[model samples]
Target: DLFVLPSYYENFGIAVAEAMSVGTPVVISDQVHIWNEIERSRSGWICSCTVESLTETLKEALHNRAEQLDRGKNAQIHAKENYSWNAIAQQMIKAYGEIQRANSKSANP
Candidate 1:
């Protein structure tokens, strides 16, 4: 399946990752914050948010099913490596630990 999200402004793109986790390739607008990651991972295609760009991107994705399937597999792999909840939780824990240490140091000084 091809998932397309044309957001005007996105701070983060959890939905795209979520779709990719299940082996669904995505087509998103450049406005998404994760566009670079998507492009780099070959998990999806990104285009301008204009109607013409969207249409063209959609056509490309649809016409190239084999390539898209490969991308979808890659997307699932990428999602497993990067976006899993366990991984995210670990990162958040590390950040919180750093913040706590900083706060403790500040309180002592």
Candidate 2:
């Protein structure tokens, strides 16, 4: 399935993430922060929030079945690598360990 998120302004655009998580190719506005990653990974198409841009991008996506499937595969891999719960939890654990180490040092000194 193709997912389109043409928001004028978005903080995180969790919907795009959700779409990518399930291997769906997306067409999102450049305002989404994750657009860069999507573009780099070829997981989706990124365009300005204008109707013309969205229309053209959607047309390109729909016309190319092979590209769409390839991009969908990339989307799933990218989401698993970058946004998986285990990966995020590991990052948080590392950050908290650093915070704890700094606190301990400050307290002891």
Candidate 3:
């Protein structure tokens, strides 16, 4: 129903992505690297790495089933659109192109 990770420090947060992929709304701390994506997608709640913040967010996230379901759906869509293999590949290709362009400009100059 809900996935909560209130870690003091997190890197990539693959677990959060995995949960979003499965349409599970999350409550993650700001320390998670992917928290920005989560916040942008409106797929879950973000809280500070404190018990009070976590508890309050958990309560809010658990309070309404309808809102939870909506957020879950948003999470699923966000994961598919951003974290899917195709999406990742496209991003990589775009980054490579940018690097190539920058290199070309430096060489020509």
Q: Name the candidate that leads on TM-score.
A: 3
> Stretches of candidate 3 above 4 Å error?
none
Question: Which ranking of candidates, highest lDDT first?
Answer: 3, 1, 2
Clashing pairs in 2: none
How many residue pairs of model 3 clash at the backbone? 0
**Candidate 2 vs. true structure, TM-score:** 0.87
C-alpha TM-score for every candidate: 0.83, 0.87, 0.93
Residue-level lDDT tens digits of model 3 in 71-106: 999999999999989889999999999999999999
The predicted structure with the larger lDDT, 2 or 3, is: 3
TM-score of 3: 0.93
- Root-mean-square deviation of candidate 2: 1.8
Number of clashes found in candidate 2: 0
Considering only N, C-alpha and C atoms within 3 Å, which residue pairs clash in candidate 1? none
- 1-109 in candidate 2: lDDT tens per residue? 7999998888888788788889998899999888899999999999898989999999999999999999999998988888889878988999999999999999999
Clash list (residue pairs), candidate 3: none
State in Å the error of residue 28, model 2: 0.3
